[model samples]
Target: MPIKSLLILISLLLFTQNIAAKEYKWSNKLTFLGFLKKHGIPQKTYYKMHKEDKELIQEIRAGQSYSINRKKGKITTINIPVSDELMLQLKNSKKGYTYKYVEIPYDLIERTISIKMKYGFKKDLYRATKTWYYGKELEEVYSKSIPFNKMRKGDRIILFYTQRYRNNKPYTSPQIDACLIEIKGKPFYGFLMDNEKYYDSLGRQYKRTYTTRFIRPVPNMKRISSRFTHRRYHPIHKRYRPHLGIDYAARSGSRIVASSKGKVVFKGWKGGYGRTIEIQHANGLKTLYAHMRGYAKGVNRGTYVGQGKTIGYVGTSGRSTGPHLHFGLYKKGRAINPARYVSKPSAKTIKLKGKAYNKLRKLVRHYRPQFRETRARKNSIIKKESKKCLNCFKKLPPRKK
Candidate 1:
């Protein structure tokens, strides 16, 4: 072929290749359902995808981007990023549209964060670490001892955690390995332990106990709306009466677990206490759960429930004003304060002598420096910002003529 004809042919081939591999970006302004409709995806295809993967029904948030791959104006594939580390993909093939849930690989990064609280401990932790989910996990780790709501300004916290990243950008919140909260200048340290439990610096488990006599009924709830008191004005009855149980304030439908391994003595409605369940444990201890929405499947009378087994969910069944679990404890058929029984552990510290103690000490030392440096840098930035604001204020002319 002549040179001129060959050049024209090459140009045409390049253009065709570009058209065949074209890409387009789309944002989800409405729900995923609306997006599917807008994209002209058939209802049958959508239903099939939904049936295969229930997560397909999850609504794509506004401003989230999805990429489309087209070959000569016909879409060949679509990729929707459900999260930083997970992508939901649909591809057009000879067999029809195929759905695939792909996990994007992430780099694990270890980080240390130390901050002095100006607001809530949770809020400060999130601000310092840029991890919103860390608050819930940290709260759960420290809920047994630390009164997070009662934390005051200037309380300091140091944490060692791991975060997932893709291309140096964070993908998920930090998973705390160890943390230390200084409340009133007294440091309380929590370290991750076996079975994903938290233990104190002295090696005592936070939520778990050495002895199985007592465990937390509701693991996630941290706030106690009402405690066992001699006499208090009843919210429903509007009269002074002796309150036997402690009311743990949690969202409705929150899991309520068995405090210790026990037999379900009663699992039916009690007149005053709505949707109540009673369990008779070893050592003549009986626990009662009231104001439950419903019982878990197969959790009936005479069912042998293990410790931490979810038996019911929080609800306002009978004599309750809001969603809370009314937890009661009885010893040998005599009513007792659940708080005393729940908080008072048989052992305070797990003995970690010799090699175990040495290993833990080394780990703490390795992570402590990173947190200190981060805290120092943050303090320096705050000081500089404050000084700059003061200078700007001074440079301003005196109040208008």
Candidate 2:
């Protein structure tokens, strides 16, 4: 009886040990995403941060433990490390997403930029944040939303893109990105879950083209000031002051055309710049006319001038510069070389330039060869069809009356 009792006690102990040893292990067998949902954590936050990373999408292994730490109902951290050439690190619930939008400035040194939001984070990703670029006053740039999906680890972006001028001047601005993540097994590089957030934030089109104004800028015309003799070293100053403005050689009092259509912001003497006119063009562009013998009739400050219209004439009035028209081009408030904007003066010139750049030569060469090949193929097909019809003795029926 005692032996029987001992055997029963051992059996009970073994049963208890078996139940207790059932280890709770998570696997890559279940979707790493599915596990998060089953555990009752938010998937939206995770999805927002890594949606754009194609490599990360490929490396997710089922049955692999996704190390995460939670506080209350929110995910504080996620560490599923993958290794690749581009080092990508993901961080959960770091700081709220932030951004500032800025408009192009007016002046030549600095542009007129406006901010939408100050630096702050919202609880929800749907909220918009704004900021501005201030040269003198605010210019109203748009706000940006937190990119939940496109916001990946090690992701970077620019708030504003500096436009190129004819002279190819360089401008500097800040580039910002999210912090890097460190997962255990492999380092998933270039992973941004929903990073397309900032780019798509303003609902602004990714692709852009000029459509509103009819008058576009021209490019590559000879400037008389760029002549070699004018570049001679000054004797008194004992230093070389390269000619600042480009001179277009023309007859005295010739019809000086407006480079682009814009309101005349200033039309008067600008120091040594004699009888000058400045026209404000669209998209932060401006043009200057200097050394004019006389102003064009009906041309004045605040007047809307059309492109190619006679705004003034040539003269050597300001500082003995020369009898050439001094032309200037300004973009984002900075002076650029004028040669970049000289397009054709008429439709005929435009067509000629297009023909030079287009496939007219290649098309001419290919036309005869392509026509011959097509004719041969057509003849072969006709011969085959005729032979087949004759063999079948398929004749056309009489047309109905």
Which candidate achieves the best lDDT against the true structure? 1
Candidate 2 local distance difference test against the native = 0.40
Cα lDDT of model 1 by residue, 207-231, tens digit: 5332336777887885998877533
The segments of candidate 2 whose C-alpha lies over 4 angstroms from its true place after superposition are 1-223, 227-242, 343-401
Clash pairs (backbone) in predicted model 1: none
TM-score list, all predictions: 0.41, 0.33
Q: lDDT of candidate 1 vs native?
A: 0.65
- Model 1 — TM-score against the truth? 0.41
RMSD of each: 19.8, 30.1
What lDDT would each prediction earn against the true structure?
Answer: 0.65, 0.40
